[model samples]
Target: FRQIVVEFLRPPTHSDEQIRSMKAKANFPTDIGRRLRFENAFCRAWDLNLPPQQQHDVRQHILSYMLVFTTASRMRGIHPDGAPGLFDHTYEDNQVVWKPAPEDAAGMPAQAYGMQNGSADRAMGCLLV
Candidate 1:
């Protein structure tokens, strides 16, 4: 996947026009369409007997993941998988800081999307409790 992306972003072998057309297609809301399609399919796949709070919790958890994934994926420079590191610290004076984790010592950039309110971490915590 990395190889493919690196190749795609490289020069003249792929012209400006081709790159523009590819990006134009790739920029479309395909993920939204696919997610909506799957959401409907999943809704039909199971008849949940869950209570209201349980249902709300389930939806919140799903939304939390979606929010984090979307924000992280759209972040400048870093890949989606690296977004999880953004949750590894506590808010300090309203600033997002990175606590050194062995897996990701550099941590996510403070300016990364959704770093405010610790949304991703908060959502993950809500999932556990």
Candidate 2:
């Protein structure tokens, strides 16, 4: 499980040859969106197949670091004036313009954007345990 998390957090390489040389098959997908969807499905399946106690433990671990994940997700882009880095952006009238999220209004789902109120309250309950 630690290795799974580590691999997920690792930065992607630019060279296709480098990605192909990696032992983990999960890194083979070049498309970021497709790779994310695949990894999400993989994690969901793994969690579902685990025993009840193990599943609970996994959820606890995730909840424990919810704040870190939330902060990282919310701050995942480069400054418009700074180098674009990994994120794709465009120039508008000689000014940098970061791409918008898929849903301009609500943005992504609560889980993707970090925990919602109900989930945060639930996490607090777990922490109190």
Q: Write the per-residue lDDT of candidate 1 for residues 7-81, one digit (tens) a residue.
A: 124323334564345434331211211123122211211111112112111010111011112122111122233
Question: What RMSD does each model have against the real structure?
Answer: 16.9, 17.9
Write model 2 residue lDDT over 34-68, tens digit each, in one string. 01222331122121111111211101111111111
Best by lDDT: 1
- Clashing pairs in model 2, backbone N/Cα/C closer than 3 A: none
Question: Which stretches in model 2 have alpha-carbon errors above 4 Å?
Answer: 1-12, 24-68, 71-129
Q: Write down the lDDT that model 1 would get.
A: 0.22
Lowest lDDT sum, 10 consecutive residues, model 1, at 55-64
Show where candidate 1 strays beyond 4 Å: 1-11, 28-129
